[model samples]
Target: MRESKALQVLKGRHLRLEEPLLLSTVSGVASTKPALIRYFDQKISPIGIITTKSFQVTPNPGNREPVICETTKGNFGNSVGLRNPGMDQALAELRALRQEWKFRCLLNVSLSANSVEDFIMLVEVFSEVADILELNFSCPHAAEGYGASIGCSSEISSDYVRKIKEATKKSEVPLFVKLTPNVEDIGQVAKAVVDAGADGLVAINTVGPIVHEDPVSHTPILQNTIGGKGGCSGRWVHGKAVSCIKEIRMAVGDDVPLIGMGGVSTGEEAAEMVLCGADAVGIGSAFGTVSQKDWEPYLNSVLAEAEARLKPGKEYLGPKSETYLAEDRQMAYRKHTVTKIAYYGKDTIILTLDGSLPCKAGEFAFLWLPGIGEKPFSVAHNDPLTFVVKKRGPFTEALWLLSLGSDLYVRGIYGAQLENERTDKALLVAGGTGVAVLPALAQQLKEQGTEMTILVGTSESVAGKALLEDRLSGFGSFTCVADDGKNGRVLDLLNGLSLGPDQACYLVGPEIFMAIAAKKLILQGMEEEKIYLSMERMTLCGIGMCGECVCGDRLTCQWGSFMRYDYLKEHAPSMVGL
Candidate 1:
């Protein structure tokens, strides 16, 4: 077991690091796979599993694009109307995991219904197959009158919990009710769930359905048009998640297990969740943002750093700014490229500028748009440090107006480090603008004589093919997919490629595309350790302090933007962005 300063904070039921456990109730698919199991054992020990919602009885496709999005904050927004494979499939997956995994698995079954009976039926069906069942009365967007709509109401929350309590009378596994952060006072809701017999609580799911524009299309990014938009998360969401956890912890007292999530991407962040009242932490966006190959290392690094910081002699690296830059040679800039613009398609213009340092494939740099503010963008390449940007916000809009050679202020190689050292077989999955960083990664992989395959998914034909011809040309074996049948969906291309077990799959782009890919990989029986994916989120403060990026137990900006696909497949399935 790893040592942690947080060990002290973990007392009573809160202290459980038998292995590195994560309250991974956020993943949608790939819930129970060997790869996920391996990741938990290798990266985070003493693991727990949380499967995505399988409706009480039927299978359903959740939300559509703009199911998740990349805002200036990091990545947020998902309108996935509670899609799941239903309880039958969920139970089968659970039973399989219980029989196979060496560790004790906690299946956080997220369920929703229009009525308490719907919730009860769900409980009865899968209650015996898993360790824990989470009542997801708090989903921001659900089929009419379901999910958060009911969770927000104390009466509804109470009745639903009570019904499930009665239904699970023979089940020893505890029941955790996962709540939303949208309420003005979530304490009341927490009390209701507890009084109704919830054994534990997973405090604060994503806070909103905030929407953004497509700049060029002037249309909503999501296909659902008007559902709960995926909320922004990262350092920004920390205070809120903590506040909610603290309040709920206080309300329920210490007897009830309280798991903290949201904006937690590092061990320190997870420790904070513990301190704030979470017995365990849940990670979502962090795992979703990066490729699977990068996932375990990212979690291990976060936990390792957190453990180090908690030690007696360790020095805390507060924010990675003026302090670290001075002591670390890696942060210093080798050369400065003042405002330089490169045309990316017809609608997007990538601006490269000067700042703290150059960027690597998995690392991100910050762009300060003066009046519009600063934003973090993945370093597309280091040979020529670049940012693939869309003309969305005021700063970016103003940036578009600038001619080539215009001076642009840049800063940071902030966020988590990339596993540039890995020699694993690589599978790159990119969606829309996500293809930006692949060029550099592909280039390096090719240079190293590593075989690489790039799969790009998009909804448009022109955009899909353009990414392939213009940017991905230099990379080995590039394939593009368009949902509208523009060229071919990346999924089909992947089928043709015949991925092997040794290959590490990496994904970026829209959340759903990544989710589908991750799930597909898992179903294909790929090791989760070999699957990789990336997620975009609302990142602020660059460092881990801000809580805006927490998805279950991870923060995308600080802890990851790169991760193993299996890590995501096991936890936070819905938020995977597939």
Candidate 2:
């Protein structure tokens, strides 16, 4: 009798550090090219397997803001629109990973397409860099003719898997088929793909394209929700994931490798997956709760817990000295009372709260109104915590009507602390309501003892110039742009200013405005790397879990809201478009 190949462990090829547990990170957690490649650089990631988010044949801008909402502990509903940089860019990212990360982990590249021909083509090309190729057949909310369309039918899934395996057979890269649980029979689908030459199988994708809405508004939160439905994962799918794995194992027997995932957040759950018939467990929505720094220890604890659960009478291994995900303050919300609301014009106002959370320049915080909805806003002042709110949407309109001393909930300051980039002279440019990120930024420059000039541009009437100048001009020389047949536009003022290599500019505003400003600075002889543009967009989850906050390839929530022009040009061109 011999040990089945299916039961074979995923031992590190080069890591001699004993038999490490087989832990894998699902796509969309460290999904982007920069995040996936850079996260493993410091070896902070303890997991042995990394799955790239499903890359399409073409780039997807994803859905609009409010694409993700946390429904319960370790569970949330999301409609990220299957966002990815498409194939060519994704290939470049994988190539960079080859050049940078030489660690002892398996690189799993996941692919999604409408037809078997495209799937085969992807396999032929990506097999060059992939240790494993995961076929994403189970994304519940993907567009028609893709994902669940192929996964729901055993014949279509088998056909796709068979052709892809044939195309990449010479490459010897392991082929894993990820199937949907929304099908008629999980076992039949599992049997079909395995019989078609799937080397392994990943049981369960998201459970449903279920609708999650704000209680009071009775309106949909996710922008791409079709018929008001988005994919459901995390705590809600735990039981279904376990049962699906059990059915998949019973159907395929103990000869094929299987990865079970769905709402798996704890060690006990991981153990349960294995007992039911999973070779390795995949973790997804749980990452939504853990901050970037805590990813390593949290996974380590889950791995430890999974191993412990297997032992019949295991003794208590004592407390985990490393901080766990549940304890991370990033997820907790603090209640605060609204003390003051400055009516700086009808649209722009400064709302002050009694308490504060640790925030920094360029970072943002989420304000949640019970029974209403939550939205992210930049903190202008931290002590007695103040926010510069622009009355744009329903959320801001509610804030405008909020009575004084009303209780409100707030959490985070998401991005990392802004590092002081020393310069002889500095330029601060802001437009419209983007002035929120300016005050804190000005404060930092002032403390650095660096000479800075501030430029404010507004679409609104410049009649309230004194009110803004009173709060802003204290840092350095200040100029307001008013094109009222008196003063020319902000660009005209920028044209007359001095520009040099030794000067750094921090610019944030409307995307087109910032892009044009960055281009102007570069044209005026400032170094491209010296100009930092705010990359904040679609920031629903304060953490990078939702994949909604991605601006180009970088998730601004974790990668810092302000990025240099040189970096953006090569990675995110739209941020510096001409």
- Evaluate all candidate structures by whole-model CA lDDT and list the values in order: 0.60, 0.74
Provide the RMSD of all predictions against the true structure, rounded to 1 decimal. 11.4, 6.4
The digit string of per-residue lDDT tens for model 1 on 301-322 reads 5655554544546554544211
Candidate 1's TM-score: 0.55
Looking at model 1, which ten-residue stretch has the lowest summed lDDT?
324-333
Clashes of each: 86, 0
Q: Candidate 1: misplaced stretches above 4 Å?
A: 1-11, 15-46, 49-54, 214-219, 225-228, 307-578
Give one digit per residue, the lDDT tens place, for model 2 in 5-91.
Answer: 222453121122233347677876554455544554345455767788888878877665455676444567777778888889988
User: What's the CA error at residue 532 for candidate 2, in Å?
Assistant: 8.3
Question: Candidate 1 lDDT (Cα, whole model)?
Answer: 0.60
Question: What TM-score goes with each of the models?
Answer: 0.55, 0.74
